[model samples]
Each structure stands twice: as C-alpha cells, then as structure tokens.
Target: MEHSDYDVVVVGAGLVGAGVAAALAGTALSIAIVERAPPPPESPAWDTRIYAISPASVRFLESVGVWQALDPARIQPVRRMDVSGDAGSRVVFSAYDAGVAALAHIVESGAIQRALWRRVGAQENAVLVCPARCASLERDGKRWRLGLEDGRSLSAGLVVGADGRDSWVRGHAGIGATLEPYGDSGVVANFATERGHDGTAFQWFRADGILAYLPLPGNNVSVVWSTPEAHARELTALDPDAFAARVAAAGNERLGRLTPLTPAAAFPLAVMEVEHLAVNGLALVGDAAHAVHPLAGQGVNLGFGDARVLAALVREREIFRAPGDPAVMRRYERARREDILAMRLVTHGLQRLFSLPGRLPAAVRNLGLNFTDEVGVLKNLLIRQALG
Candidate 1:
C-alpha cells in the first residue's frame, strides 16, 4: 500500500472516464485519470455536441455529486416527448403518464463531462493526469506497466481503457473492433425557437433521416439531423433565417420556428462493436468498449452504464483482485452485455426500418408504436427498460 503508482488507472477524461474514477474514489484503490489532451482551460458556455441523459444516468450522476453542482437553469427537463414517422404516424409521452417530472434531460455534452471532472476533482484518492500519451501497455504478473510518451512509466493493479472509439489501449490489449459507417452524418446544433418548447422533445422518422429536437435549458432546443452527408452539409450551410425555416418545415412546424445557436457541423455516422472488453491486467469502459447508433442518444449513457457496473464490481469485491482481473472484468462485461446488446439491436433495427420506404415494414413499425401507445403499462415498462 506504500506504492506511488496507482492501484487503478483510467484512460480518457470524458464523461464515462471521470464517472468511473469518481465511482471508484470511495474505495481503497488509488486511481488516476489519463487524458491525451488536457481539459479545456475554460469550459465553454455551450457545445454543439449534445446528449439525451436518461433518468437512470441522472441518478447515477447525482450519486456521484455532479448533479448537485450543475446549474439548475442549465438543465432542461423534458416534460413531454413527441415521436412520429414521416408516414403520418405519431405518439407522445407525457411526464404525468410516467409519473415522473421528466423522462430525461437534454444537456450539452461538455457540461456533463465538466460536471464529472469537477466531481472527480474532489476525490482524495483520484488524480487527474493530462497531456499524457500512452505509448505501450505491458502486463506482468498480476499487474500492468503503462508506458507513456512523457518518458515515464507507471504500474497499476488495474489499467482501464476508457480512452475512446479509437483506443490505443484496446489496440494494446489486442481487442478487435468492427466499425462501419451508416452512410449518414449527424448534423447537430442548437436553435432559438419562436415559441417555448414547454419541455417537450420531438423526433421524426423521416425517409432520408431522423430529425430530433431536444428541449434545451432555455426556450431554445437542440436539433440532431441524421441524414446523408450531402443533406447534412446543406443544412449546416443554411443561413440562420433560412435554416430555421427549413428546420421548422422538416419538423412539420412542431416547435414553430428554429434558429441556429451554434455553428452547425456534420459528423459521419458510424458504429463500432468491439469483440470483447477485457484484457490481461486491463479492462475497457465507455467508448473504448462499445459504440451504438447515435439515433438513440445513449452513446455516453452506455459508457456510463459500463462504469456503473464495473465500479460496483470493484467496490464490492471480497478479494483484493486487481481492477483488471479477467474473471472480474468478465463479470462486468456480462452484466452490461444484455443491456448494450439490446440497445444495439433496437437502435440498429429502428434505423434500418425507418430509413427504408417500404410498405409492410412501415405499416408494422407504425402499428407497433401505436400499439405501445395504447398499452400504458407495457409502454411504461418499455420506457423504463430503454432508459436503463
């Protein structure tokens, strides 16, 4: 216990990485969070990147202390959500029906990352290391040796690669990934609406893309347009007024008018499913472990879910096993596989079914939504399950 090296080392300083570090901070383990780039000196006011945080995720963040620190005014509660198809089929969910104040919140991605980092900053057992590049990972008996570009080396009982989609640790661990583009780009931005959102989020399953407007902190809302790269760029290039008009029309004028809040940009859509999440003296968490269709808005949530389960396992373990025990890591991976796999199938299925203009599948899909709408108990259960 007199070692200067950490007991646990977490790579990546984003939401999931920070959450994992903070989650393990309560334990006896000494943890370190490594990031290739240092966090922004000044956390930006807003970011084009957005995330739909589910209720479960909100509770987890609250448990970790970030929720209390976030400005109340900056958190947008989604009282209602409207979902529909281009075929004129739709359904709406109200917080009253769910008996919850909000189904979820749409917050700037940067805000949550900062929140987690801030929470982790208070951890007496965790250290934040940045501008550190990982050159190689060597697993010796019962431990890991982390080589960095800074001409320094550190040893840990466990090394976690929460790094990201393009993870050096995953490569170092010999884990393989299957990545493929969805032939689309997700164009994301915020907007000023003529009318208040009333805490309602809207999503449309269009033939060419999926258009969603998530209620923001103010009267504003954020838009995510997943469509062909050309269309995405075209929308991003539109002037404020023209863009607002076009967005309104595309949304069927659901929220009245839309105005860009941030400079919009298009990111190529892709999905990465890793073969396995564990390696010798190493385990993967967050984007380093899996990637899902963004259309579901659970990318980071899935990563956090990984963090939650992994942290629980480590904290509750009876033996003094390294953080990266293959047996223990498998338990973590197994705990998450069902949830992550279900989400992957659901998101992928929705994207494929809605993106196609078919006769029977469209009817079936629409019918399914309406069916779920009518079945109150079933719908609630499904929502709860989906949020998890």
Candidate 2:
C-alpha cells in the first residue's frame, strides 16, 4: 500500500476537525485531515442548521483565520436573550449587562465549515485528505497506522477523532460511550418573520418542549423546537404553510406570521459521554468526546473549546514528548473535564427538571429562572462561563 506520514492525523473534516487543523497551522507538527466527503456546496437559501458561537470560540476562530474569512453579511450578533418558562416566569440577559459587545454570534453551520475548510486548504502544514475514509486503524509500536478506503495508508504519532457523536475513530480505538436519548427530536427550520427580532434570541420552555428562535439577518429567524418524537414527527409532516402556522402559535406569535424559507428537519436528541477522552496515542475532540442538550446552544461552542485546548496543549508540549504521549494527552483531557461535566450537568438537569409532570415542579423551575435573573452577579458569572 502507498504510505504517508504525519505528526498528527485527524479523522474528520467537520467544523471542529477543520478548526483543529487550522489552529495547528503555525505549529512545527505536520498534520493530515481524513474526511469521507468534500466541503458542502453553497446554497442561496440560508441553512437551517446554525450555531451560536461563544466569545471564546470567536477568538479561537479568529486566531485560526477562519473568522475573518466568513461573510459578515450572514452573521448575526445576539445582543440579548429572552427566556420564558412554561409558567409566566421569564429571565432576560443583555450583552451590555455582561459588559460585552454581543453575547454570541449566530452563523450557519455550513458557513463556518466552509470558512475553516478554506483555511485548512491554505494552511502550509495541513493536508486535506478529502473524499477518503479510514478503513481501519492499528497501533504500530508507539505510533498509529491508518488504512484509508482508497487503498492509501498513513502513519502518525497521534490520531485525533473529531468525527462527531457516531465517531468511527472512537469505535476503532476501543472507546465506549454512554448515550441517554431524550425521547425527543430537535426540529429546525428557517423562517421569514413578520416582525424584526431586534438582534435578540428568544427561547420558551413549554409543556411540549423547549423552543428557540435565533435571530438572523434582516427579518429572518431560525427555529429549533426540541419536542418529543411524536410531536416532532407531526411538525415535520405539516405542509409549509401549516408548519409555519404551528411554529408561530408555539411561540405565541412572538415573531408574527412565519413563512418557511427552508424545509423543516428533525434529528434525535441525546446526551453522549465517552468512557475516556484519550488512551495511548489517540484523543477525541468535539462531539466524539462529549455531547449536551441544545437548550443552552452550547454544543458547538464546546466542540470549539475542545479544538482550542487540544491545539494549545500540542503546541506547548515538551520537546521530548511525542504528540501522542499519554501524559501530554491527559493534560488536554484534564483541562476539559470540569467544563464538559458542568455543561452536561446543567443541560441534563434542566431537561429533567422541566420534563417533570406536576404544576409544583413547573412553578419551582420558573421561580428559579426568575431568581437567577434577579441576581446580577450570578447571572454575570453564568454569562462569563457560557462565553468560554
């Protein structure tokens, strides 16, 4: 088999993987990105799948040169967030209150991926091995040997898995994962709202589930309704007009009449945690390492954090330590443990708390929201944590 070698091999070219490659562009280590598919084609219609990029993630992307490459016209800054519980309780957060220009930036997932892909393509030390797949992975003494589906082979001191929740690399590396299905699906779609969102994001914890209206450029908004499987199926089955009507009603007509800009899609909701983040010469990043509920819109942000920390650790490793040294990889895992655990606990706890079946529970949770909102110091701390 034809063979190649690199200091690190990344088995995924999604946003997080690409970001990792871009972030390591200036490092002395050579890197290769193995992807099964090419970058997504551009479309005139806005993508329904979007992510709220946290401030820390924004700085990471900026350092990697992906942020500046994105189209500014398509990005929307979240100046404020308005969250309402099933009851009458509501909590509001403003960027100004947090002493930041914007709480977060809402951008289409495709845009970010494309921008990062472009960066990786131009990166001197990064190689894009797209339209390829890892057929098998094997341990070669102190290194990793990967066999590609295209009959090519590569060796690396370290292998990074950024292949997402159903990671192929993680499975091959003998990593086990525990998955908790929420019995729900996240229904997402784009809409042209009758009223302007005024650069504000709105969320509602309703009896059905949690719904969010993320503001977009102009009068557009992206909706993610996390509902039970049956309800999500019902929503996806509706015609465009009917779906629009149902969504508008769910938000209490907050955005007025809604006109679908794209077809609605739904994906299962689940929290997945891996047994171990790294073992020997392998490490996991992004959804491959961990996943959380989308109520907080922190999933992608967490993935970006993974890339940021892993790249930094790799860059600062001791000269004698290989990129895949167990001790070096452990540091990256340890640094991320608390942040990941805290987010999982918060998102999972909120999901369970709201799913309880009783008026008392609803009242208590709503009251908690109100109380948290009233505490300026506490809210700022929460905001700062989310910013990372």
Candidate 3:
C-alpha cells in the first residue's frame, strides 16, 4: 500500500470540507482532501437545493477565492426580509435600515460546491483525493492515520471531519452527539413568480409549519416548506401545477400566481449537537460538529463559520504548536461553543413554540414577534447577528 504524510487530512469534500481545504491554500501545512465522489457536473437548470449565504460567509468564501469564481448572474441579493406569525403578527427587516448592502445572498448549493472544488483542485499545497472511501482511522503515537478503501495510507497531524451529520470520524473518535428529530420534512422547489420578488425574502410561521419564499434572480424564487412528514409527502406527490398553486396560496399569493420551474423534493429535519468540537488529534466542522433547525436559514452558515474559524486558527497557530495541539483544539471549541449553542436553542425553541396547539401559546408567540418588530434596536441586533 502506498503511504503519504501531510499536515492536515480533511474528510468529505462537500461545501464546508472543500472550503476548509481551499481556505488553507497558501498556508505552510500540506493538506489532503478525501471524498467518495468527484465534483458534480455543471447543470444549466437551477438546483432545487439552495441556501441563504450570510454576509460573513460571503467574506469567508471570498478569502478562499471561491466567491470570485461564481457566476454573478446566478446569485441573488436579499434587500429585505418579511416574516409573519400564524396569529396575524409580522416583523420586517431591511438591509438599508441596517446600513448593510444586503441581508444575504440566495445561492444554489451546487454553484458553491463546484466553485470550492475548482479552488481546492488548483491549490498548490492541497491534494484532492476523489472517489476515495475511509476504511479505518487509528492513532499512531503523535499523529493520526487514515486507512483508505483502496489500499492507501494517509498520516496527518490533524484530521478534520467535514463529513455530514453521521460523521465516521466523529464516531471513531468516540465523540457523542444528541439528535432530536423534528418529525418534519423540508419540501423544496423552484418557481417562476407572476410578479418579481424585488430582492425580498418572505417567511410565514404557520400551524402547518414554516414556509419561506427566497428570491432568485429575475422573476423566480425558491420555496422551503417545513411541514409534517405526511404533508411533505403529499406536497412532493402533487402535480407541478397543483404544487405551485398550493404554495402560492400558502404564502397568500404575495408573488402572484406561480409556474413550476423544477420538480419538488423533500428531506427529513433534525437538530444535532455534538459533545465536543475537537479532541487530541481531530476536529469536526460543518454538520459534523453541529446542526440546527433550518427555520432561521443558518445551518449552512454555521457550517461556514466552522470552516472559517478552524482554518484561521490553524493558519495563525504558534510555530511550536501543531494543528491538532490540545491548546489549539480547546481554542477552537471555546470560540465556537457560544455561537452554536445560541443558534440551536433559539431555533429549537421557536419550532416548539409554533408547534404547540394551544391558542394561548400562539397568542403569546405572535405578541412577542410583534413586540420585537416594534423595537428597532432589538430587531437590528438580531439582524446584525444573522448577517454573520
């Protein structure tokens, strides 16, 4: 078996994983990225899977050179956001009011992934190990070794687990995670709105669930309807026209009639929290470290936060300290705990509050929304945090 040595080994070449490798391009550390599949082929049709990229995340992508590679025509900037409570209460946020250019950018998942792949592939100090699977991971004195399925061995000072929710590295390292399934599925699709979105995003917290209309470039938008599993099944099973009409009515036809731009798809929802972000010779980023309810549209943003923080820490570490030094791991955990905990608690609490069937609960929640809306300082504070 061929053997290799590196300063960092990153597992899973998804957006966050690739971001980590790409972000460390000019660093002295030699990096290796392992993935089971090659980068996805480019597609002209819009991808149904999309994410709201926070301003802070945009800067991270830019630093890694992935942002510049993205096609400007495909990106959509969000100027305003309108959120409504089921009990007829509402809150509005504007980028102009916050003194920012835009709240966030609505981007397709594939575009970012492809861009990151291109950057990492060209990075001088990084090696892209595609179509590779991890067979075993074990400690070798001061370093960690990864055994690949294709009879190759990789030894590194640091192992980064950017794998998805069910992370093999996290499991092998004996890190525990608590998962709370919401018993709901997020149904997503794209549509051509009868009216333009005007760079505004809309969200409704309803008895059925939370529905969000995220604007795309031109007269198009993407919708994420988080509802019960049964309802999600029904939504995906609907004919294109029927699904579009139902979605239009749910959002009060605010964007007018809708025409299907893509077929609908759905995925189960859950909240995950890990016991530790780092151990002696290993660290977890993105979904591997934590996952939150998507209502706030911050899951991927949090993952990007993980990638950025981890990369910066590694790049700036003292010469005497290794990438997986105990002190470095502690710093990474300490830096991220507060942000991750706050987002998890907030999203989970909101989901439970809206899921309660009692009228009193609904009244109180909506009242709180309205009150927060009226408080300019409070609303701006929330927006500022979200902008990150």
Candidate 4:
C-alpha cells in the first residue's frame, strides 16, 4: 500500500468542500480533497439547480478567486424581494432601501462547483483525489489515517468533513446528528416568464406549502416549491405545460404566463443538527455540520461561511498549533454556534408556526408579517443580516 501525508484532508468535493480547499490557495498547508464522484459536465442551457448566494458568501468566493471566474452574463442580482402570507399579508425588502448593491445573486450550482474544482485542481498545494473512496479511518499517533479502497492511505493532522448531511467522515469519527424530516420535499424547476422578473425575487407562504420564484438572467426564473410529499409527486408528474400553469397560478401569475425551461426535480426536506462541529483531529463544514430549512435560502450561505471562517482560523493559527489543534477546533465551534442555532430555531419555528391547524394561527402569523413590513428599521435590519 502506498502511504501519503498531508496537513489537511477535506472529505467531499461539494461546493463547501471545494470552497475550503480553494480558499487555502496561498497557504503553506498541503491539502487533499477526497471526492467520490467527478463534477457534472456543464450544459449550455440554464440549470434547474439554483442557489441564492448571499453577499457575504460572494466576498468569500472572491477572496478564494472563484467569483471572478464565473460568467457574469449567467448571473442574476436580486435587487428586491417580496414575501406574502396566506392571509394576504406581505412584506417587501429592497437593496436600495438597505443601501447595498443587491440582496443576493442567483447562480447555478454547476457553475460555482466547476469553477471551484478548476481553481483547487490548479493550486500548487491542493491535491484533487477524485474517483476515490474512503474505506477506513483510524488514529495513527497524533494524526488521522484515512484508508482508501484502492489500497492507498493518507495521513493528515486535520480531517475536515464537508461530505454532507449523512457525512461518512463524521459518522466514522463518532460524531452524532439529529435529523427531523419536514414531511415535505422541495420541487425545483426553471421557467421562462412572459414578463421579466426585473431582478426581483418572490416567495409565498400558502396553506399547502411555501413557494419561491427566484429571478434568473434574461426572462428566466427558477422556482422552488416546498410542498407536502404527495403534492411534490403530483408536481413532478405533471406535463411541462401543466406544471408551468400550476406554478404560475400558485404565485398569482406575478411574472405573467410561464413556460417550463427545465424538467422538475424534487428533494426531501429536513433539518439536521450535529452534536459537535469538531472532535480532536476532525472538523466538519457545510452540510456535514448542519442543515436548515430552505425557506430563507441561507443553507448554502451558512456552509460557505463555515468554510471561510475555518480556513481563516487555520491560516492564522499559532505557529505551533496543528490544523486540528484542540484550540482551533474550539474556536471554530464557538464562533459558529450562535449563527447555526439562530437559523435552525427561526426556520423550524416558522415551519411549525404555519403548520398549525387553526385559522387563528394563520391570522396571527399573517398579522405579524404585516406588522414587520410596516417597520422600516426592522426590515432594514433583517436585510443587513441576510446580506451576510
């Protein structure tokens, strides 16, 4: 068996994992990224899998040299957002009112993934270990030894798990997680609107589900409908025209008539909480660390924030401290605790609040939305926090 060594080993090459490795570009640390599958090939057509990238996340990507590489023509800036409640209550947020360039940028997942993959693959200190699988993990003195199915092994002082919700590295490292399914699945697809979205994003909290129409470049928009499992099945089963009509009607045809631009897809929705973010020589980032409701569209941003902070801490650590030093892990955990807990509580609370089976509950929630909308300072505060 061939044996290799590295200062840090990142498991999973998803957006967060690749972001972490790319962020360490000029560092002295030798990093290894273990990915089981290769990145998907780019398509000329718009992708259905879209992300609302927060402003703060953009800065992190820029620092890692991934943002500049993206095609500007393909990106859409969200200048305004409109959220409505089932009882006709609404709240609006604008970048101008918040005094920012934009609230967030709508981007395709593949573009960022491919860009990060290329960036890290070209880095002198970063090694891309694709088409690889982890077979075993064990403590080898002060370092962690990761065994591959191909009879090759690598040793690293720090093992960062960016794998995902069901993180292999985290499980092997004895980290436990709590998962609560929302009894819903997010149905996603792209559409061409008769009228352009004008760089605005729209979301509605309905009796059946939560729906969001995110603007895309040109006259296109991406939609994510977090509906009950049964409804999700029906949505995906609908023909292109039927599906587009259903989606358009749900949003009150805010963007006018719609035509499907891509096939609809669905993914189960869940909220996950990990017992610990790090233990000894192992630390976790991205979905490996936590999972939250998608209503706020902040899950990816939170993951990117984890990568940015973790990389910065590793880079600025004391000379004598290893990448996985207890102190470094402690700081990472402490710094992220509040943000993770806050988001979890907010998303979970909202999901539950609207799930209540009473007209009174609906009225109260809708009234709350209207009240919040009337408060300028409160709305601006929310925009500022979300801008991060």
TM-score of each: 0.94, 0.98, 0.98, 0.98
- lDDT: worst 10-residue window of model 4: 317-326
lDDT of 4 by residue, 1-388 (tens): 8989999999999999999899888888999999999888999999878999999999999998999999999999999999999999999999999888999999999999999999998999999998999999999888999999999999999999999989999999999999999999999999999998999999999988899999999999999999899999999999999999999999999999999989999999999999999899889999999999999899999999999989888988636548888888999999998989988898888888877767999999899889889999888877876887
- Residue-level lDDT of model 2, residues 180-275, one tens digit each, is 999999999999999999999999999999999999999999999999999999999999999999999989899899999999999999999999
Segments of candidate 3 deviating more than 4 angstroms: none
lDDT of 1 by residue, 1-388 (tens): 2224888888888888888898886777888888887555435456677788888888888888888877777788888878897777878888788888888887777777877887788899998888788877887788888878777777898888998889888988889999888989998778888888899889888877998998887778889889988888888788777877887899988778777777777888888888887766678888888878788788988988888888888887625746666677879778888888888898898898887777887888788778878888878886776566
Q: Is candidate 1 or candidate 4 better by TM-score?
A: 4
- lDDT (CA) for every model shown? 0.82, 0.92, 0.92, 0.92
In candidate 2, which residue ranges exceed 4 Å CA deviation? 318-321
Off by over 4 Å in 1: 1-4, 41-45, 318-321
Residue 347, model 2: lDDT of: 92
Residue 319 lDDT in model 2? 63
Candidate 4 achieves a global lDDT of 0.92
Report the number of clashing residue pairs per model. 0, 0, 0, 0
Clashing pairs in 4: none
